[model samples]
Target chain A: EAGVAQSPRYKIIEKRQSVAFWCNPISGHATLYWYQQILGQGPKLLIQFQNNGVVDDSQLPKDRFSAERLKGVDSTLKIQPAKLEDSAVYLCASVTSPAADTQYFGPGTRLTVL
Target chain B: DQQVKQNSPSLSVQEGRISILNCDYTNSMFDYFLWYKKYPAEGPTFLISISSIKDKNEDGRFTVFLNKSAKHLSLHIVPSQPGDSAVYFCAARADDYKLSFGAGTTVTVRA
Candidate 1:
């Protein structure tokens, strides 16, 4: 079985530029998550989706960041007018049962903003 | 407010020895704890997990111990191997399945 897939393994943009990251979770996985991992820091949960419905996104920056999981299989995270602080690896993960902590992650998209 | 914390920034262990990584969390609401391994420029992979109900969960060379009373948990790698070298992250989950992570601890397994 293949693991979670993420597009554009790396991306570089200016501070004011916009960028989008895509993710495709594993088969039969109902839960999808997006995490931001800054340098020397652990991955922080940005948003989570249970199938097509959103489960949580309290820590998400609603003004600059947005994510959607249409039909609940694939997800896309977009950042508008990116900031220097937004330069981090965006990781996508999925799990069959969301109640526990068994998340399988993709290779992640490293975003570099100058 | 950082809920989970890994005080040690790095750890160095000789091969065939034990490697213990510690974590402390402040949120008592977190009912599940997990450990993840991450390589440079790569996303973190799930290493092992333990529920609040159990104090210890072991799988092969990896073992995770949870202390709900102290809000502390730990991951122990027995007879550490160079292949196990990576940044280890400790995470906690609340009732809503939202995971709170701590700063990672980079582990170096010396051959």
Candidate 2:
């Protein structure tokens, strides 16, 4: 019954530097997601993976952000040439399946780009 | 261009009183709505959910009401407790698997 796990609960990087966040979803979960949450706003979906395959990434900024899930169990989100606007919390979540609506979230990596 | 919006940035209610949080969505295709509660430094946790077909769903002291015609939804917590203080996010899902979320409302339950 362990929940989603994320690494480096907090991160700091300079503008134009690269940063990466990691996520390990609940065991047996079939769907994983990455989200960005700016201050005062809710988490915004960045990308979704359905068992090592992308389900949706329309909102992802391909020019700077990318994510991948290997073996459908763990995921990593990367931001290259980070901008000041990228100073926000990067959250990782997972759902049991496409039929399930309940999403379990991790503590999130708070990225501060200076 | 935000599809879901929670207008209230924060709310304060006395313990044992009622706390009501409102949310509005612009999309007509959204059929499933959910509420999540989050504490500082922690990710959001699923609180309650209501499908479009139903007007109200209740779990213990928490209730969610959805108005399809107005594209509005609300969460109500009765006899609010100090532990209930947290940010609450409203989210909606359309035909697709993605969910649209609103800027959350922070609720403070004063003892």
Candidate 3:
């Protein structure tokens, strides 16, 4: 079976610019997630969606970051007025069920803000 | 306050030897633990997982041991191969569906 898919494997933008990342979860998956991984650190959960509804986004930066999964199959994460500290790999993952423990991850979009 | 921690930044082991990675967690609510392996440019792939009720789980060459009393867990790769070299991350999950991850440990299997 195909795994989670993400667009624009890499991205570069200047500080204060805006950037967006896309994710397509595995077929029939019910849960999707977005995470940020800074250098030398593990992925940090940014947001989570169960179907078209958000399950958790407490860690998301409301002032600068936003995400949506309109149809429950694909999702997008956006960062406006990007900061230098936002230069990190944005990862997308999905699971077959909310109770399932394993999460399949995508290659991730490596964003570099200069 | 980091809930999960992988204290060793990296580890090196010879091929045919054993590679052990350790992780600790401060949260008692975490009932499920998992280990993921990641290459340089790709995302992490699930390796093995052990529930809190079980002290050990093994699959092929990889094994995971959990100690609920100490709030510690470990991953063991026997007869380490070059292909096993990668960053290893330990994650803990509760019923809330949120996963807390460690900083990760880089393992280098030498031939």
On DockQ, the candidate that comes out on top is 3
Which runs of model 3 end up more than 4 angstroms from their true locations? none
Worst 10 residues of 2 chain A by lDDT: A94-103
lDDT of 3 by residue, A1-114 (tens): 998999889999999999999999999998999999999888999999999999999999989999999999999999998999999999999998878979999999999999
- Residue A60 lDDT (model 2): 97
- Candidate 1: what lDDT? 0.93
| Cα lDDT computed for each candidate against the true fold | 0.93, 0.94, 0.95
Candidate 2 residue lDDT tens string, A30-71:
899999999988899999999999998999999999999878
DockQ of 1: 0.77
> Which residues of candidate 2, in runs, are more than 4 Å off?
none
- Per residue, candidate 1 scores C-alpha lDDT tens digits across B15-96 of 9999999999999899989999998867788899999999999999999999888899999999899999999999998887
Candidates' TM-scores?
Answer: 0.96, 0.98, 0.99
Q: Sort every candidate by TM-score, greatest first.
A: 3, 2, 1
Docking class of 1: medium
Model 2, A12: alpha-carbon shift in Å? 0.6
Q: Looking at model 3, what is the TM-score of chain A?
A: 0.98
